[model samples]
Every structure is written in structure tokens, then in C-alpha cells.
Target: MFKVCGYTCNRNDFLKKHMRLHSGERHYKCEVCGYACNQKCDFKRHMRTHSGERRYMCKICGKEFTGSDQLMKHLRIHTEERPYTCKVCGKSFYQSAHLKQHIKMHSGERPYMCEVCGKAFKRSGILKTHMRIHTGERPYECDVCGKAFKRSGILKTHMRIHTGERQYKCDVCGKTFISSCYLKTHMRIHTGDIPYKCDVCGKAFISSGDLKAHIRIHTGERPYKCDVCGKAFTQNSTLKAHTRIHTRESPFTCEVCGCACKQRGTLKKLMRLHTRERLYKCEVCGYALNQSGDLIDDMKTHSEEGLFMCGVYGKTFKQSGNLKKHMRTHTRERPYMCGVCGKAFPKSCNLKTHMRIHTGERPYKCEVCGFACNQSGSLKKHMVLHKGERPFKCEVCGYACYQSDELTDHMRSHAKEKLCEVCGKEFKLKGNLKTHMRIHTGEKPYKCDVCGYKCNQNGTMKIHMRLHTGERPYKCEVCGEAFKQSGNLTEHTKTHTEERPYMCEVCGHAFRQSCNLKTHMRIHTGERPYNCEVCSKAFAESQTLKAHMRIHTGDGPNKSEVRGYACKQSSDIQGRNRTNVTFAMKHSNMIPGSNT
Candidate 1:
């Protein structure tokens, strides 16, 4: 019914040739070479290579191409047109194939599969490189080092070393890198961009790999297992290093120290320790540390303000991990069990050292003291005590201490020095101030069970409990003297040491303990909190008030400091006089506060 025109007939022939190009059915042949093409358009483009013809030209950039399709794609860049859009995520792309790849992000689809390993990838190019694992084919080779790579892109990056090319540059730090991806990661420091976040802990990371590792902490999933020892690791690299332990491999050797390590990273870390290099530092305390993890742990100490409470004794510790371990003492739960003896401990290191005790093995030895210990940490602590090292210091009083416990005890002096502005009464301790305030409120919270004896302080009830139980837990290690309370033991320890750690601010006089220091501070403040309820007499100390109460109770005479003093007998006096007579005669020419 219709007649075909000459132009329509020629267009039908051109469409038939384009369909053959898509099918890859090459039929046309070249005369000079053995090159074959499916369509006349490809053969015409190939002839332009010998003729040096550049027909297609870009109007925006004035760039020329031999093909029309290449010119059309290049023009789209200047037009800024993206016709392709992903239906799954509503993401638009300039190309249809790019939109298809974007849909895979939502679908989690990995269509490309490798026949050799049964592994899959979202992209075909990734699967192609993965195939090299079975074939051992490295097609791309570097001219400089002659190192072959499965992917041509890796070889191209390797060639940068021989060419001395640094293409990626950071605008903030002015740092140059060979790869753009590495430069983009380094830029996160200046930008503070943490795109990756953990779903469980709400912790953000700069990189996705860090987020992946952090997620394992919440999931407790360790997929990487060592085949030789059947040990599991959360990270694959850690498992690889653990495998080397079974193989007894020492591949990484330090050039300077001549020390060999199983892992390369361990060798690098040891080199930094030997060099005394502190790359990471704490901003709060100016504490320099060799590793970033050490800096993080140190920051936790400052944030907790050195207040760590033990769950078992209702006592506080300076370290959190110490309190965590001490909690096991109350629950009697030991998670780290010995494999051979079936004995368990709160900490893994404790269990390890305990095993050595049964084996009669002392691995850690003191170089100077010649003392052997089961653990290196125990040896280090012993050495510190031997050296008389006082590293910890109190910030309030500028007092240096040998241990954290001593610093905590020193800070109690500051708490005792707090005075009431209205009453001008100083408290011996914060707890004492709180209890004395309850007296103004008529609040007697602590009631005894035996005689309904009521007191304002819980500490008074604890002291009263000794009457019922007849228990005295405090004992002196120096003189074998027993006490009903810890305060008495602390006071007795001073008699053996003759060491006074607490000192007065106004006067140069020192005291044996913080309680004595608190009593001395009342002289400067002119405040007395303790009162005699019977006669309305006020005293600086509760002991002085107790002595005043004796006057009201008609109990006995209040003894002074020198009331118990007695002169020695004639035989002892004569012996002391004979020794004094001999020493006085010898040191008569010596001046006071001077060597004779």
C-alpha cells in the first residue's frame, strides 16, 4: 500500500549495520591489516587513523574527535544534563549504567560472581581482579621495578614512584600525596568530618574500616580464626600475626636494634619506643605517650577525676580498671580460668602469673636487685618502691607522693580546712560538717538496735557496733598492736615511722596525720564546732569538749597534756645523769644545729 523513498531505503540499510555492531558480528575486512569490523561506521573511523582526519569538533572546548558518539558524550559535560535516575534511592546520575550501580547500594546486590573462589562483587571489574587469585595472572608490569599487578590502575600508581609524580595536594596542610583517596582521608583532620558512625555505640569514625572494627566490640563476633592454634581474632590482620606465632616466623627485623618480630607493625612500634618518640599527647595534662591508645586511656583518668569506688568494700580507688577488678572479689567470680588446674582469677594476667607459680617459673628478674618475679608488672612495681620514687602529686597542696593513695590522703586536708562564713566554725572533715548540720535540723538518722541509742553520724553507729560483735579488724604490722578501728592503727603507725606527712600552713609545725592537721587549722580560723550541751561551753576539738563534759558529768578530773608525766626512779635517773654528764662534757664546745 506504501511506496519506499530512496532516502528511507538507505536509512534502513544503516540501521541494519548498527544492529550488527551491537551483536559483534564482524564481517568487513581491511586490506593492509587483518582488522575486522561489524559496521561501516567503525571501518570508516579506523580509516581516519591512517588519513589523520579529525572531523568531529566540540564547540565549547574546541576539542576534536574522529567519532560522533564520543563528541556527543563530551558535549553533555558542558550542558550539565543527567537523564538517568535510580528508582530505589532517587539518586540521579549522568549515565544509565551509573544509576544501575547506585541501585545496588540499596539492594545489597553483588551480581558478578567468581567461578574459582565462589566470591561475588557488585562490579564486574572487581571480580576480574579477584580471578587473578586462581590464575596467578599479573598482566600489568612496571618498567622500573618489574613488579606485575593484576589491575592496570595499580601499575599506573606504581609508575608514579619512578616518575616522581605527586598529583594530590591538601589545601589546608599543604601536604602532597601520590593518591587522591589518601589525600581526601588526610583532609578529614582539618575538616573534622566523621561520615562513618557505629550503630551500637553512637561512636563516629573518620573511616568506614574503623567503624567496622568498633562494631565488633558490640557484636562480639570474631570471624578470623587461626588454623594452627584454633585461636580467634576480631581482625584478620591480628589473626595473620597470631598464625606466625605457631609457625615460629620472624620476618620483620629491626635494622638499628637487630631485633626480630613476627609482625611488621610490632617492629615499627618497638622502634618508636626505643627512639623515645611521643607522637600522641594529652591536651588536658600535657602527658606525652608513645601510642594513641595510651593517650586515650590517660584522658579517661582526667575525666574521672581520680575517683574510683570499689564495689566490694565501699572504698574508692584512683583507677577505674582497679575497681572493676576489685568487684570480682565481692562476687567471687573469676572469668579467666587456668586450662590445666581449672583455677580461675579476676584478670587474665593474674591467671597467667598464677600458672607460673605452680610451674615454679620466674620469668621476670630484677637486673639490680637480683629478685625474680612471675610477672613483669610486679617486678616494675617492686623496683619503683626500692627506688623511693614519688611520681604522683597533689594539685591542691603541691605535695609530692610516692603513690596515688598518698595523694588521695593528702587532699583530705583541704576538705577539713573548709570554714562556715556565718558561724566561723571549721569542720575536721566534709562528713563531719554534714553531720553537724543535721544537729541544727534535729535529725538523728543513725539509731542503735540494743538500747535505741541515736546518733547523727553513721560512723558513730559503726563504732558502736564493735560493742556487740567485739570485733577489731585493725592491726599494726610494725609492733603487732591491735586496734578496734582503722584510725587507731593509722595513729599507731606514726609512732614506728616517726614520719609526719601533714604540715600547717601558718606555722612550720607538721602533724602525723590529716586529722591532727585539721585540729591545728582551727587556730588560724578561730572556729569551734564542738559544744558542751550541759554547760553551753564551746571547744575547738570534740576531745576538748568531751573533757569539758566530764566537768558536768562529775566523772573525773580532765587531764592535761603533762598530767601523766612522772620522774624516773633513783637508779634510772642516776644512769641517765651519768650518760648526760659524759656527753655534755664532750660536746660542751659544740654549737647548736651544727656538727661537733
Candidate 2:
């Protein structure tokens, strides 16, 4: 027997080989691959990596491994087997070295100590790396450039930029990487295998490292911190990118416009302006978008889920940006400023339309009539004349409308009601009920700052502002006429076309305006809405109230007074207006208090 250090071997050659382990000698060499080992067993294990030989197999999962040690380690995952237990702490581990590391914590035994920071570590390699941090010593330097790295592995990875040596390649995607671990992680994307899952969110990740990173989001933990600014980030890469702002380093440059950016992502985004590349596409609509965010926005048309909601109207929106734009409709926020003219708009699209007047740019054109317009909305409206398209149809009432807004307004009549507590009136919509309650409550919330004019509705206040401002915004291109209200302009346009949509059921007479038709209905119904407070007499029209009130004011004659001086006063009545003449004739006495 041959014995060296508390170990005996059967043969002298075996003892010599065991001595090589302590001596760090690699005598055994493989001719096929450039692999050398201190012992024959290690050389045989290394050979299996090149030979595609996997002899050991897991009994539970039938997973093959090149070595028995590799298979034995993998079985712990299925069996939950931990054989090695720490005698001091009773902390169990699958490997004996892990148990040895755990026992060191209780013993307070640190073999490796940093000279610079006075920090102690269990391993010599970790202590050596810690010393380099205080010294700022990057020993591994690049061959092409003077760029240095702290570790040899980091230097090897950096050299891939110069050499373009992708040692590991993905079998599925053909994606290349410098390391085997990165290739293993890339394989999960093809396999759709997520081993680690978040307990809170149930979001699965490829690796335990990524799972740990995601858990920080739930824990509100930001371990990676910026030393320069003291700002914390979820990711180390984000902190690295943020450091460039403080340094004023724009490393990434746009090749097309020579524009410099702090990050490569910003440069790629800038390049899209020249490339016009729309990579993302909507699955439902086939609408191509330049960015993934825009694709998410466009996909909202298909989804019923609206994450963002309006506080005022209770209207839901898919994206926060759409919700922000919708809130502007309530707040009347006009942030978009016109540079050419000092004008602001509630929306950017509205500002864009206003710019066309200054630029004389009419991009939108009617396909049927070839009528060019500044806005696409105008072009769409113009198309209705040619096609008579009424796409917006009321579900309850068989009525169709050209505009979606008209249909939305028409749908209000069909909606379920909410009762007003003050008036006991049922309003189809909650907003209308709120307004109706305000009328009874005498709450005139919409008040004019200029004239102190108060109104119950916001629309009335808007219309009243035009009186003070003298702003005629809506203009007719046909007759060169303009109006303060858009509704007035819409009615005026109908007169030119001679289109009378509203009709009287009694006389078969048609009117261009719906309000005119409603007034005409009052004649047949004889509904006396206006009542005099003094006389207690009701009239069909409000104009009739003025004529009736003239009796008490000595402006007109009573029936008894008129008949006393009939012929002489009647001639005086003929000189008066038609209203006074009708009053005079209605009275049998057209004499007294009827003097000219």
C-alpha cells in the first residue's frame, strides 16, 4: 500500500495520481478536444460533453445526464432530498460543501479578509474581487482597446464585441450568446417553460434570478441604487443608463440624422422617423403601429376592459393616455400651443386642423366628389351628402343619424331613468337628473365672470360667453356667413339645401328646424304654457301675454270701453299695430281708453 496524506491507495501509480490533486498538475490530456485533467476520471467526464454521451438517467423524470453526480444532484429537486446536515445549526443541504458553508456562520470563521475595507468573506475568490473595488483595479484589459474589467469572464464576454465569437447558440431561434447560461435561459422562451412563479401576481419567469427581481416589485424593494444621485431603481441596467444623464454622455448616435442619445433605445426610437418601420400590428384590425405601446392602445377597440375611468362622466378608457385626453374634455385643458399663431387647443388634433388655415394645407379629400378639406372629420361629413350614409342607428327607435353624436343624444331618450328628489321628475340619464335637481334646488352653478350671468347648464354659460367675447367661431363656407354657435350654423346650412326634415303631423307641413315643428304642434294641441300672474289668464304663445297685459296698463281698450266710442276709436285702432288691431276688434267696446 502507498499512503501520502491520511489516504492509502492500492497501487503506487494511483498514489502518484492522487498527489497531482494537491500539486495542481494536469498530466492526462485528450487528443480529440483541448481538455486536460489532473486525474483520469475528470478527463473521462470532460470527454462526455464532446461525445454527446449521457449515461445517467433520473428514475422519476427520465432526464438524462452525462455524469452520475449530475443525476444525483437533479434527483433532490423531485425527492426533496437533503442528505448533508450541519451539526452546529442543523441546516440541511443536498451537497456537503453547502453544509460546510452554513456551519461557518455559527463558527464565525472567515479565512479570507479584505485589507482595504476590513470585510471578511468565507471564500478567497470573493475576497480577492472585494479588494479590487477599493483599488479600482481592473486587471483584465482588452487587446483592441484599453478597456479593463474586474473579472476574466467579464473580459472574455467584452471581447465578443471585437471578435464576434458567439460560443453558445440557441437551437430554436438561432440567437447567439457568449455564455452557456444565457443560452439555457433563451431555451425557456422556445419551450415556454417557467420554473419560478410569483406568489402574489402569479407571473412566471424563466429563472429564479428573474423571479427574485419581480418579487421586489411587490415588496417595494429597490436594491440596485445609483451612487451618484442616491436614486434607487428596480434594475441595475436602468441605473447604469440613468448615470449617463449626470455624466452628460451621449454614447449612442443616430446614424441617419447624426442625433446623439444617452441610450441605444432612444436612438432606435429616433431612427423610426427615417425608417418609418411599423413593427407592431393589431391582431383584430390589421392596423400596423411603429411601437408596442401604440399597438396596445389600438387593441383597446377590441377589449371590453377599460382600466382608466373618468371621475365626472364615469366613462371608461383602456389606456391612461386616453383617460387623460378625456379628462381634458371635462377640464377643457388646452395644452397644445400653436407656434405660428398664439392659439391653444383642447386636443392636438384640433390644433392640427387650425394650423391648416395658416398653412393652407387640405390633406383630406372626399373620394366621391374630390372635395378637399383641412380635417378628416370634415371630409367624412362631406361624404354623407354623396352617400347619404347613416351608420349610427338608434336601437330603441328605428331612427338613423349621420353623426355618432346625434345617435348618442338620441339614445338618451331610450335609457333607464333616475328620479330627482326635489321635483319627482324622472330623467333618462343621471347627468340630466342632476341638472333637473339643480333647477328645483335653484343651484345656478354655471356663472359668468364677466356679467355675473348665472345659468343651470354649462352649454348656456358657453353660449353666454360668446356674447361678452363676440366670438363667431362657426363659419359657413357656402354663403360667407358666420355664427356664434355651431348649432346655428348647422341650421343655416339646412336653409341653403332646402331640406326640411321636421314635419307637422296635423297639416302635413315640413320645417327645416325640429323646434319649429314642435311649436307648430302647439297650435293643434292648444297647450297654454304661459299664464299671467295678475289676470290668471293662460295663452298659447308668450307673445300673446304681452298683448293681454296692455289692458291693465291703459295701452289698449277693454270690450265695454271700446263699444262706447266705436267708429272714432276704431279708426285710431287701425293706425295701431296688428296686435292692437286684433285686440280692438275682439272687444265689443272699442271706445274709452283707446284714444290715439
Candidate 3:
């Protein structure tokens, strides 16, 4: 007898053939497939796959295989026999190869390791599948969609999507699934068996994948990152959903309103808006919500226990995420930033809400009035008008309001005033009085570093900085025109409609803007706020004051010709004025048909 590399052989020639496994020698090669093997018998089996030859057949299921051992394994399904059983877990399998793989899992022995990523696997076949991630080799292609996959088993499962073949059925719910593993996970809903649990958070999950994703919260590990925004997420699916913000891809569509969403879960929630089906319910308060996350948030209101505490202000929140957001308020951390507008926000939802102004997406709508709005909070406020519900009221004056914040603001009228010493201006809040003082002191602290533009308010500085950056984030949906400020977008939207709310009482003239009406009123009052410093001449408009100053500087119209300069040909001035007009029309949408 002869032995080589743990394989015993009866002859020396057989032992020499077995030695080729470790020696990295492949003598037998198939001409058609280029499949090389150490043994001639294994090489012959590889040829049978391309030849479409099945020599052995199973009588019970009418299935065929190229080898007798494969036929024998198929027969075990009809016999309902699992001869190979694991001693550790009592798990059984039909084939000895499967049992060997299962045993290695119990021993935590992963001998097969990928050379590229260093990922260990219990079986060599699994390691080969993992190698495709680095190699970019996808051999299995779908016939219908042409979508490629790395493994044959995954391709087989994907074929079920086209065929609609769901063989695995749950006995309890009668729900069907594509695979037995999915069915097993579904059965846990009925069994209430959450076997997988996070050791760090003590949160239980139905599957190991859910537990693995939950563990990332404690580890602060975000393996998946966005290529465009550099935003990291714990799950790959979450990163995929986030990438839609840059891509603007809305694959999932609603049937009723033709509304589109980037994710299927978002489409499902949008469908609930039309259906009005409250699927998630609170056990304590009997409050129902269409979204499960909203239900989870509502459930927190029922309990005061396990509240997260803020270190700075000592404020308590029901969720750790809310507590983390509260800490950012104290730290003045604005992590979520808009790539388009170059604006930073403390919360991601604030950034998302800000993005809708640029996107012109009015996702929320009033079902009663057919009115649509961008923000969900705006929709909720609009719904209050239709519902006519004044739940919040002042206790002292009986001043009722739709929102609690409005009632709180009304309560300030009853409180003592915060007086400004310089101007004798009485404000309801101390912060308002502080802002009022800046006007009297001529103090403009918020300044743009780019243009040295000064403003008393930080928000005005942010808007002014956009002028230097040439960023017009707000966009009109109808004309596809962009604007630097949201107030400019609001004024531009009025051009799309003939709804002029501002009117002159003296002249009976209507205007779309209150600022225009206020300027028109100055003509009737003969009030000239803009006064020329050179001649003490007054004008109703600031542009008139600027034109009057040009006369004193000898730069007025026809003044250069009077000074014997021949007006300087002014092609450069005309070109610069044209360029300025073009830029202003592009960013501020001053011209109506410029976008078209």
C-alpha cells in the first residue's frame, strides 16, 4: 500500500495520481471547456455537462445526473432519509459532503480563505463564490433580464422571479416563499421565536442577518459608503437608498397618483396614503400608524422608562437618536449638509426637507382640497385648516390656535416685555430684543468672508454667500427656473398664477408683491427715504438715488461727452452689463422665458 497527502491508495500509481492535488499538476484536460483535472475520470465528468449527457437516472422523481453518486443523493429525497447526521447539533443531511461542511461550522473551522479579501469559509465552493467580488466574474446570466450573478444557486433562485415559482409554503399563514430558508424565517412570526440576539444591545431578531446589522449600532461600523456624498451606512440597502438622492432615481411608482419613490418601502407607505390603512398599532394607547417606525416612535410616548439623557442640558428623550440629536444642539454640530446649496443642518430630516425646495417635490398632499406641499409638517398644518381643530388655547385670554407653538407664542403677549435700552423697543422674547439692539448699534457681525458682505442676521449672510458661490438651490417646478433664496422662489411662483393679493387702497391698483405695493404707497405719501448725500435731493427708489450719485461723479449718461471724453465707446461697459444681466437672470430667474 502507498499513501500521499492523507489519501491512502492500494497501488503506487494511484498514490502518484493523488499526489497531484498538492503538487498543483493537472494532466487531464477537456478540449471543449478547458476544464483541467488531475484524474481522467473527473475530466470526463466535466465533458458530460457540455455534451448534455445524463447517464444515470432516478426512478422516483424522473431526475437525471451524469454521475451515479448524484442519482443516489436524489433518491434520498423520495426515501425521506438523512443518513448523515451531526453529533453536536443533531442536524442531518443526505450527502456526506454536506455533513462534513456542517460539522466544520460547529467546530468553527474555516480552512478555505480568499487570497484577495482574506475572508474565511468552511467550504472551498463558498470561497470560490466570494472570490467573484474581487475578480468581477459573473458567469451566470439571466435569459430575460440579462442580469448576471456569481453563483449557480443564486441564478436558480433569481429564475424564480421570472417564473413566479414559490414552492415553499408556510402552514400557518399559507404564505409562499422562493426558498426554504425564507420560509423558516417567516415561521418565526407565528412561533414568536427570535433565536438571534445582539449581545451588546440585548435586542432580539428573527434572523442572524438582522442581528448582525443591529450589532453595527454598538460597533459604529459602517462598511458601506456612498461614492457621491461620502455618507456611510450600517447596511448596504440603506446606502443604496441614500444614493438615490444624488442619482434622482425613482424606480418604484405608485399606481394611484403616478408618484415615484427610490425605494419599494417608500412606495408601500405612499400607497397607504391613498388606502388609509393603518397596519401598525400600539398595544398601550391603541394608536395606529401606516409606518412601523412611526408606531415605534409613538410607543415610546407611552413609557417613561429607559429614557436617554443629555449631558449638557440634562434633557431626557425616549430614543437614543433623539438624545444624540439634542446633544448636537448644545455642541452646535451641523453634520448633515446640502451638497447643492452648501448649507449645513443638525438633523438629516432637516436637510431632506431643505432638499425638496430644490427638487420641487411636493410629496405630501391634502386629500380634502387637492392641495399639495413639499414638507410633511406643512401638510399637517394645512390639514388643521380643513379639520378646524383648535386643541391648543391660552388659559388667560382664551386665544385658540391650531398648533401648540402658536399658543405658546400667544402666551408671550401676556408676559412682561424684554425692553431695548437704545430704541425703547419692547419685544416678547429676550432674543428678539438682542436682535433689535444690533440695528440701533449699527453692528453687522455676520459677514461673508468671500465678498466682505456684512449682515446683522446669520441667515442673511448664508444667503449672501450664495451670491459669491453662484449657487441657486431653490428651483421652480413649472418653469424649471432656479433661485438663490427661497423667498425669491416664492415670488417667482406667483408669476405662474394671476393671484395678486396686495392692492393699493388709494389708486385701486393690484400687485403680486407686498414690497412693490409698499414702494407704490411711498409715491402717494411723497416719502423719499433714499436721499442724495451730494445735493440733498430725495427720490422714492434707491436706484434713483444711485443714478443721482453718478451725476456728481461725472459718470452719468452723456456726462463723459460733456467732459470732452467722447463717451469712451462703452462697448466694455455694455458687455459687462450684458454679462451681469445674464448671470442674474440665470441664478435669480429675473427673466421669465430665460429657462425655456
Identify the candidate with maximal lDDT: 3
1-596, model 2: which lDDT tens digit per residue? 43446778688888888888778889989988677888877888888988989999888999998888988888988889999988876778988777877778898899888886789998778788888888999998998998998998988888987798998987654668887888898676546477998899776788888898889889999978888989998877788898987897889898896777888768877887789976565767889876655766676667765357789988878777778988887898899999996889888888988999889889677666789999878878778878878888887778998888788877888776677776678877778888878777899999888989999999989889999889888999999898999999999999899989998888999998988887788889988888988888998777678676766565645233433432223444554445555676656455655554
Worst 10 residues of 2 by lDDT: 560-569
Model 3 has a clash total of 0
**Candidate closest to the true structure, highest TM-score:** 3
Off by over 4 Å in 3: 1-28, 36-46, 53-64, 67-69, 85-92, 102-121, 166-176, 186-206, 210-234, 276-306, 309-316, 327-344, 352-596
What TM-score would each prediction reach against the true structure?
A: 0.41, 0.35, 0.57
Model 1: which ten-residue window has the lowest total lDDT? 559-568
For model 2, what is the alpha-carbon lDDT of residue 43?
A: 82
For each candidate, what is the lDDT?
Answer: 0.77, 0.80, 0.84
> What is the TM-score (0 to 1) of candidate 3?
0.57
lDDT of model 3 at position 317: 81
lDDT per residue as tens, model 3, 1-596: 33443567678888778788888999998888687999988887788899999999888777889987788888889998999999998999999999999999879999999998788999988998899999999999999999999999889998997899999998864768888899999777556587997787776788999899899989899999999878899999999899888988988999998988999888988998999988666777888788755865676677775567788777788778889888887899999999997999999999989998889889898889999999878888888989999889889989899987888888999999888887687999877888788998999999778777888988888788888888998999999999999998998999999778899999999999998999999989999999888889999988778766776786635323212332222543555565555666676657777767
